[model samples]
Target chain A: MQKTLKSLSNKDPQNIILIGNPNTGKTTLFNSLTGLNQKVGNFPGVTVDKKTGNFNYKETKINVVDLPGTYSLSPNSEDERIAKSYLEETNQNDIIVVVADATNLKRNLLLFTQIVDLGKQVILVLNMMDLLQKNTQEIDFKKLSKKLNCPIIPINARLDKGVEKLKEAVFSYQQKENIFLDSDSSSSSIDETMKRVGKINTIVDDCLTKDGEDKSYLFTKKIDNIVTHKIYGYLIFLGILFFIFQAIFSWASYPMDLIDSGFGFLCDFVSNILPKGILNDLIVNGILAGLGGIVIFVPQIAILFAFITILEDTGYMSRVSFLMDRILRQFGLNGKSIIPIISSTACAIPAIMGARTISNYKERLITIMVAPLISCSARIPVYTILIALIVSEEETYGIFNLQGLLVMGLYLLGFVAAILSAWVMKLIIKSKQKSTFTLEMPIYRTPRWKNVGFEILSKVKIFLFDAGKIIIAISIVLWVLSSYAPGNKFEDISKKYTSETSQQQYSEQEISTLIASERLEHSYAGIIGKIIEPTIKPLGFDWKIGISLVTSFAAREVFVGTMATLYSVGDADNTMSIREKMMAAKNHETGEKLYTTATTLSLLIFYVFAMQCMATLAVVYRETNSIKWPIIQVVYMGALAYFSSLLVYSIFS
Target chain B: MGKSLNMTLDRLKENESGIIKQINDEDLAIQLLSMGFVIGEKIKVERIAPLKDPILITSGSSYISIRNADAKNIEIIV
Candidate 1:
């Protein structure tokens, strides 16, 4: 009968579901089983999707579905609902892998016992066994297995221990275990159920000998005393944040410079070979320079994600959420809102999507509304360049660089703006529904470097791919716009500079630079910039900035690239860095320096509040499945940016 | 205790009980309902999954899980 059941399930590729509470090392187990073969997708008719991966255990090809981490199959959130539905379907899963945290076995068993009664083929995995060793705690696995009437394997997922035993248990899985609940009609009452559970607890106690004291709760209380204390907690959190930003600035510089120089060399090499024509000029000046401008900032973005991934993986994020909950509640947000807010520092799309975790509709809406206000990674390039241009490197307050201080100020301003806006929205959109914030503070463990590395690489790849596509297309268009115009002397000038005798006579730098400038001034992009000159003039922006503004709608980081390309026109040999080009720029009409401190400040403030990217808006729409919020976001942010820039420009000018 | 209130696991209030007849919600709902929730399965109210929201119930079969806010909508007779 067991063989017949196995064969029948095998004919349909039985779905082996992995279920566990949050922070049980469930994801690590999934990674081990699937390696890089896993794919994430949404479940049918539900926004909360399932992540399924394939692996072969013995001769059986198993399709493993990694359910979302939940304390129990309580349908409070969308994630929980999706997880519960898949598990309840009798025919859906052939076996269930219940990953439980060994350190907190009492609470973990709350879910394990439930799975046992479901009559599903069960493999109980005691994850984080290493943490038990660290805490000097031991569990009798043999007794645990016997008590539960299921195979139990102790695993240290972080160290990849006992995984083979887990696989072996899966291979040797049998359906004959008498783990199912007997339908006793006499004990159908609530009192009877409680009595049975009490009796089971007695059985559990008899079978297992718990050793070295349960210090998990005590440890949490001790840590919470200092970390979540009102005044000191806030101070420590601020201090940690300050250090992270400082590290991002100081550590990323070396790699950033290397990338910049490498791209510069590549540009020069292309300029050397391509025989001084439109094709050569486009490749070296337009494409390479535009891409290099954004590529140089990748190191900083990657490092920022690395820190975030570590914080999230080590289970510190929930504690941070718990600590911040009280403060956030004051602004119509919950402690849970911090996740989305922090994620928004990378990009608002995912951050807004993350708002779904917040159970309260009103709080979730407020989070989504205000998330875009947090300066995202796209804004980083703009901020870095602008701060470098305006703020000197002198130390302030005896410990912080003036540039670093300015960057910090911008981040704080965004956060302040987000909170203030949320507060206002709360007043207008009143919700009387009672919302509770209950978060499980998971045990802290050393971050698995593999997961962190994978997260960073995936995010960086996504950022690069999305930004690269837009930059390349816009660069080509800008090249065409700046290269030719009807009845213009621009083409004539470019040809003359590239003519055989003139090209040979003139230095390579002079020849390339002349062709670049001529092409840009006559390109289609230049015409559009000239047309928009009137509109942007009041904000102290030139036609070059107009072109940049247009391109930056795709992504804010493209502003730096647009400026690089615009300035590269006049730069001899493309030798000057973006900063040097910006510093050298002078207004053609006014003859005043284009990137004066006032203008830089104005640009910085403009970018601080602008809904500059169409991509972010698209993502927001997709994530929320609503056009209303994204449209409102764009209009409000655009107005804020314009008026703020106008205010700064007027005051300074 | 208090008239020995009898209600179905689904019909139980913010803190009520009835045997889970069928779990309609997916993912979380199913997981919570399934732990000890099967046809004709008996359950007792434990606390809730925090926040006095989802009711935590222990099934007679030796497992505990939470039910939805509307879980009280289910009918039961003692």
Candidate 2:
């Protein structure tokens, strides 16, 4: 015994670990106990982070490690490996928190008994107690504690109930006499164990009483009857998706306009107060305009996430997964792939990170590669502006606005492209393991508002922080590039314009327009745009459009701001909207219409598939732990975009 | 005739339960058990949700949900 113990100790350090099944509110409990005093670190050699939070119990500083949630410690997947190895290697865990769904106690206790055999301290937290009332089930806590030979605490984690009792119980925990395996008894064989288990069942039956039939299963069944109905399930799913898109487009309009107008008002106010200088121009035009371009889409992003969060929280997402399994399998994806695919609509970075949850490497890689093909919110502002410019708002099919339908079609095109790409990738990458899809359909519950709100706020904040920084920096650089030059052209225009009228005669718009055009024509950016003009000419884009495309590569929405700045610089009248100005643009040499249907379609196809954002690439690099993948991703996506646009242009022209 | 294994619903019907003889795939089985399908536990199939996917089972002092695909993998005693 001493030698065995020594060998185990030599293998790994002893530590206390928290273990639980997924969706058991384990993370919630961990958060409550640890609060914000937690740090995340990777395990010695693994990419998976080891989260440790300090908790004090009876003046003893306990290092609480929140292990990844797994169904069993049987290490089938990487997540399970970390959890199982940590428990097996660590002998010093003072206590183990076996969080179980209270509504599903029988399934939860399997792990409970396994932990008991480990001969360590154990506490069972029966989470989601509030769910029991709806199911009309009651638990005999004392009886459960006696049967398991551990303290049983009932908890409603979302509401913070039973947390104090849980903490107090942990502090006061005293190890009871250990249940030892009978040595020298060959009765520990599988057959003998089964007989022993039968005896334990008798013990359990005596200790616990249940009230009412299990309604959770019944409720889920009733809902699934319609939702999973052969034809109806598919239709309802489509209907739900349609409603979500409608809500995103319609509901977010008011808040988006408010934010847009608010920023415009602020810019005007700042211009009125500050003396005219480069600093003022930088703040009002460069910083404020660029930030406003990105910020206005927050409402649309928030609404999209809210619907998704509610669906996921209510456990309907799993059902959707189940429905899509057979279809997704054909594309070399499983039901789990639906999550990343759905999340990609918000931003490809988090969607790529979400692929981490997919247990299969091949599937995960495929998902990461193709996720960006889904049109994200970053693409929305660009698409919105372009659609408004190209597609008239006349009624189509009698009831549908042609513009709305065209926007919906663009979204559908991206979806189709993503599926087709995944299918092609599936044939390229080979896997031998028999892939299986297994998910626990959690009981449906009303989505907790706090959880939904927290999710939306965190996602929005991350988007604003990461994408906002890149946009601001790029905008300032672009401003400087388009503001100054090494030529008499800018100086000559300023001098001519200022001398042509008295200082009191010139309006702010007139003077600014003259300065803007003169500076832009001789600027470094303008020189580069002219150099790239030959390449973009085949696609029917002028030097100005080429400049906007180059900057928009940082983020798709930056295209609108780039165009706005470009047009604002050249337009002396300053009376028309950006859309009208774009419509009225003509080629300098031939006086031909620049934005013909052929060029518009070609540009639309280009934006549809291009790897446009550097931030997304950086995130992909970080998540995949290799620059190789992001580089490969950018090249493949760019080639696809170029060739696809070429094909579309040739056919149309 | 073999005696039935007294296990939770999640472990039943995929095959005959024989004292849960040995949970060969321990990690996967343990997860099923922790959801409340433990050894020496009595479970009954409550119902299955839409698409015949999520199976609802009753064990310990409560009800729980598990995917049907996962349920088929569980070896149980009848």
* Stretches > 4 Å off in candidate 2: A1-19, A27-68, A82-96, A112-122, A133-136, A146-149, A170-206, A392-402, A487-489, A492-515, A564-596, A622-627, A651-653, B1-78
Put down candidate 2 lDDT per residue, A1-653, tens digits, no spaces: 13354445434433346788777877677667776666666666554557787777666666678888776544446677777777766654357888988776655655566666666678889998877787777777898787667888899988889987887877676755445233246653444334434544555557556665666666766786677666888898888887777677667879987997787688788877988877887787778767877888889889988988888888788777777776777898877788888888878876776676676777878888899999888887777767766776454655655665676677788889899999998999988855656566676778877667766876787668867887788788877777777666677767776774645677877677657665776787788788898987777777888888899888887887777666655653334455676887777557788777887888887888999988788767776778998998889889888888788878888
Winning model by DockQ:
2
Model 2 global lDDT (CA atoms, 0 to 1): 0.71
Q: Enumerate clash totals for all models, in the order shown.
A: 36, 20
Q: In candidate 1, what are the lDDT values of residues A380-463, reduced to their tens digit?
A: 898988787776555565777667778888888888989998998888778886565655555556788888876787678777
Give the 10-residue window scoring lowest on summed lDDT in candidate 2 chain A: A188-197
Using Cα atoms, each model's DockQ against the true complex is: 0.06, 0.24
User: After best superposition, candidate 2 residue A414: deviation in angstroms?
Assistant: 1.5
Q: Estimate each model's TM-score.
A: 0.81, 0.80
